[model samples]
Target: MKKIRIQCALLTALSFLMGLSQFIIVGILNNLSNSFHTSIDHVGVLVTLFAIVYAIMTPIINLSVGHAPLYKVLIILFSIFAIGNMLTAVANNFNILLLSRLLTALASGPSMSIAITLAAAITPPQKRSWIVSWVFSGFSIASVFGVPIGTWISDNLNWRFLFWIIFILSIILIAILYRLLPHNLRQKKGHGFLRQLAIFKNTHIILGILIPIFNFSAVYIVYTYLKPLLINKLGFSTNNVITILFLYGLCGLISNQISGHINNRKWTKTLVSFLSVQAGSLFILFLTSNFKWLSLIAILFMALTMSVQNSPVELYYMEIAEQKYPQSLVLASSFDSIFSNVGVAIGSAAGGYTVNTLGLGYLGLIGGIFSVLAISVLLILNKVYFQ
Candidate 1:
């Protein structure tokens, strides 16, 4: 009825907010560093810390809170997110800001996975992918609009106001969610946390976890340091950099939607093809950085390939989990989040080290290597599992 429709809208909105919180940092990095009287390198730690907390806390939170009533947990987590965003807005020092970022990240762990689970719970199995895709589209939209708008705000107004905006959005989402979502959507009896954890023993589950790590390590190696590459290597102005990012986001949005449709037809081959193109795109980017237009085109290609790869990998994990214990699918999603965030942390650290020790030009080279390695892993997995 109207209730279900409202629930879906609220959940999708919350997903968008979660994604905006995660990526808005990228757009405001310069402003934050200047405000805190720190270097951009130091501000980079906020990204690392947020990824690390999300990696560590996702499974722990899922296990502890999975059996709770979904609506109650959603409200509590959204409220915590609001508090975190508000704290970040008012923080006067770097330490306080870092702490606030971690707090916001903690809320993110449960919010996304729980939202996915709720969507799945409401939708029929046959239409689950469509529903999940609609919800997850929030992430693509965040990268497209949220990051650019945040950057504009930080440039035109105060950076703190960006967090204030997020806080207001979180508060609004809390109300919508409370009104829309079912109050008592909990299993009467379920497998205990320990039992759910046991599902990790499956080989497919372990492979699924590692695939995200490998793929995202490649992604973050380039993306985390992209701004500097555009400025220092390509000699682009600030305005150009933001505009190019907006284009990259637009390409990514289209590619993600296309990939979702492709997944229904040829999941394994689509993954392999996208990863291969991604590796090739990174290589081209590294080699072509001196050419402004060519480098921008390379970025577009990278975004397209990476977006095409995302949904298939996510769908692959969900499909594999379906053959096993269905309830543990939520844990599988949690593992996906953990490994992907861990990859972000690893890739960012590696890229940072390479940039400091070697040079910025080496970032795309390292990223290409990681992408190739990920492809190799997937090829092996495909042969073993699909064959």
Candidate 2:
């Protein structure tokens, strides 16, 4: 247990860097565009490109490397990730910066998938969900806190400093992972890429992959334009908006921590309850837009439930995969990451469309509709499968 905990912590750090590096781009997009002599929109595409690459590349990489020596694969992937960060820092033009992001995204998806796989492989069945959730919370933590810190650093120092920090942190994690991960955990008889693709044949697995997309589309529909929703719609000043965001992030971090301890045996109920409240929060946000205190409450509730859905849903995937597709455990992790990226992209785009068409205040109402759609999917999943 002690050794597994240490490995989990180290893997958590790796996951944190993955989240940090991905999101830090948003913080410094203008800086990057200025440095590269391009449009901010072009630089923003780096974010979209990174997600697309990660979503597309992860399963492809996993088909081949799934059964390789785990720690060694991590080392190689982390090395690529660190070097990509370094390349980004030293990039002279937009093309080089884009290349760096592509390399990192390619490595990041598989690296995180492998980390989650190892987390599951090393732990007992009963604790696997908790461990995976713990690992993923690192990403949540990075999103809540790291992005702001990176933005602040960019404001105070150089924008490249963010990647420098990530590169240095990743280097430290390499040594920790080497020292912590058990050497004997690798398997040689895992499924090939084509065989892993067979998971799509399983209806439950497809639904599982789409779950994040549904849930995230709900959350990010409002969250993507959160600042505007808070200011233009809810009438918050800039500093108060930051404070509200901070509170929301704190709720998210706490929610992720709580998610790690949830009972998987009742995951259907757990998922439904959280998703219901998630939908309710958006509903409340939609209704209470004019009431400052009520609006803040809705925002906090939204943040709290946004991440609490992770562990149970992940547990559901592992349980389903373990029972139906034992050889595709790592592939499940890759799918999780891949689907999550797709979710964010879809949600952001949808939110942008809603703001343009219906208006910003209507974001929560539309987001509520998305969450309700997710709830409908989960209910059908439970009735058809879990029962």
Candidate 3:
């Protein structure tokens, strides 16, 4: 029993670290650009590289590390994460920083995928949703606290210190995981990488993968350039901008918890309702950028929709994975991470271009259109495949 408790804690901590590593860039972009003597566009490459590497590596790692003991795999991955964070702290050149980011991304794919797999492994079938939600809540928490704290550290000290802080935390998490997680637990044979890839031949798997692509693209389109939009177009003070982001994060945290509880009860209706709300939120953001208070409200709603959408989408894919290739569920999660990161990179690139060319406010409009399109696709998919 105590061992199980420790496993849960370690998994949640790893989840938190994975999320913080991914998003800490959002709050430190200006500092990074200035310190590196580059433009924000150049700094954006860090995010792009991270996402691209994460997308490309997820499936490859899962395939290569087939049926390994869970503890051993986690130890190896977390050590890589620790090394990556330490390198980022001391990186002196832009190229080295980019390399460190790639290393971190490489580590992140397995760490996050394994965390989810572990949660599912330990929980009873009836409680799987709760466990998955508990694990993913780490991301929501990171959004609320990690971004703000990272921003504070970057502002008050050198940006290098932010990585150092995470590095220290990684060390502690590694120690806890080594001590607490079970050593004998192994992957089921059916989940071997090859079998997982084969499952993608199914139409449901294809649609499941595409849903994340569209959903994340819509979210990232506005999210990638949010700081600039808030400061330049919305006329928000830096402090206010941070505060609004915090609010957005908080709303997301609440929504994650709520969605986890409600998903098993009315999965389909919950998804449609949340997607509709997201569409509405994006439209509101497009129309109300000039009004500071209104924009804040819109962002809160957007956060709510995003948080609600994440778990259901994941659960949807997991269910399809179970039916088609039960053993390869972990591989499915890895694929999800890869595809989702691809979406993030594409969306960020698209959003960056649209903001530069069309106007920053246009980002919300673009995102809304994609959200609507994603919903339409899902509806069609549901009618044909799901039903």
Candidate 4:
């Protein structure tokens, strides 16, 4: 029991590092723009490129290596990830930085998918959802710790310094993981590409995967421009925005755990309820932006509802795979990470349009619409599968 607990904790830490690698750029975009002697928009392209590559490459890599020993695959992926961060730390020009982010995205997507599968493989069936929640909490915890700290590092020292830190941490984690993970760990070998493609034919799986797209689209619509939202619309100082982000992240982390604790049978209802509340929160944020305290309350409340659906969604994928599509279990694990990036890309782009056309205050209104769309999808999935 203790050994399994330690293993789960290590996987959670790996999730934290991977999440940090992916999101750290958000907080330090300004510093990156300055360091590369470019506009913030150019630097912003790195985010889009990363997400596109991540979403495109994740399933491909997972399918290619689905039969390989999990232990070796993990090490190779993490080593590549570490190398990507090192390149990011050392690159002198925009092109090199762009290439480095692409490399990191290539590794990050499959790495996280395998990590979730490994967490599930090593735990009891009953505890799978709980452990999956812990793994995901790593990402929320990154928001809690990683993004703010990266922002501070960028403000105080150099932006590249943060990448260097991540690079060093990645190396140490690789060694620790090698020692802890079992040599023979592996999943059921996947079907051929054409065979595995059949998982998408099921309407339940199709709708199940779409949940994250609308869910995260709603989030990043507002979240992609959170700093301006807090400062310009809500009358917060630059420094206070950082503090508010930390609080928001803390609430998100709390929400992840709270979602994990809900009974599995209740997941369908809980997910719909959470998304509904998220819509309400964003709508409230839209209406209350002029009132400082009320807007702040709405912001935190939205954060509280943000990550509550993650574990349940992940659990749904795994359960569906185990029950009906055992051959595609590894492939199943990659969907959330893949589609969630799709959501981020969609949301960020839409948020940009909203900012340009409707103004930043309208971001909350747009996000609320996506949240309702997510709720509608969840309800449809419930009717199709759970009903």
Best by lDDT: 4
Task: TM-score winner between 1 and 2, please give it.
Answer: 1
Query: What's the candidate order when arranged by decreasing lDDT?
Result: 4, 2, 3, 1
Error of 4 at 284 (Å): 1.9
Poorly placed runs, candidate 3 (over 4 Å)? 1-3, 190-193
For all predicted structures, in order, the TM-scores are: 0.94, 0.89, 0.95, 0.96
Clashing pairs in 2: none
lDDT of 1: 0.78
Task: Estimate, for each residue in 171-199, the C-alpha lDDT of model 2 and write its tens digit.
Answer: 98898788878887774465566776677
1-387: candidate 1 lDDT, tens digit per residue:
466556777787887888888888877777887898997767877888899999988878777774679788878988998999999999999999999999999988777878877886787766666666667677778888888878888888898998898899899878878877877775333478777677777886676677778777887877777777888878989888788778877876787676666645446666788888888888987898778788778778878766565556666666766676666666665665678889888888887788888888887888888888878877777777778
Reference-based lDDT, residue 162, model 1 = 83
Give RMSD to native, each candidate.
1.9, 2.7, 1.8, 1.5
Clashing residue pairs in all predictions, respectively, total 0, 0, 1, 0
What's the distance in Å from true for residue 106, model 3?
Answer: 0.8
Which lDDT tens digits does candidate 3 get at residues 25-49? 8778778888999977678778877
- Give the range of the ten consecutive residues with the poorest summed lDDT in model 3: 262-271
The digit string of per-residue lDDT tens for model 4 on 1-387 reads: 798899889889888988888888777766787888986556666777788898999998987875788878988998999999999999999999999999999999899999998899999988988899899899999999888888888888888888898899999999999999877878776668867767888788889888899988898888877766776678887678678878888998999998788656757788888888899998998897788888788878888888887888888887888888887888899889899988888887788778778888888899999999999998887777876
Give me candidate 1's TM-score against the actual structure: 0.94
- lDDT for position 46 in model 2: 76
Tell me the whole-model lDDT of each prediction, alpha carbons only.
0.78, 0.79, 0.78, 0.85
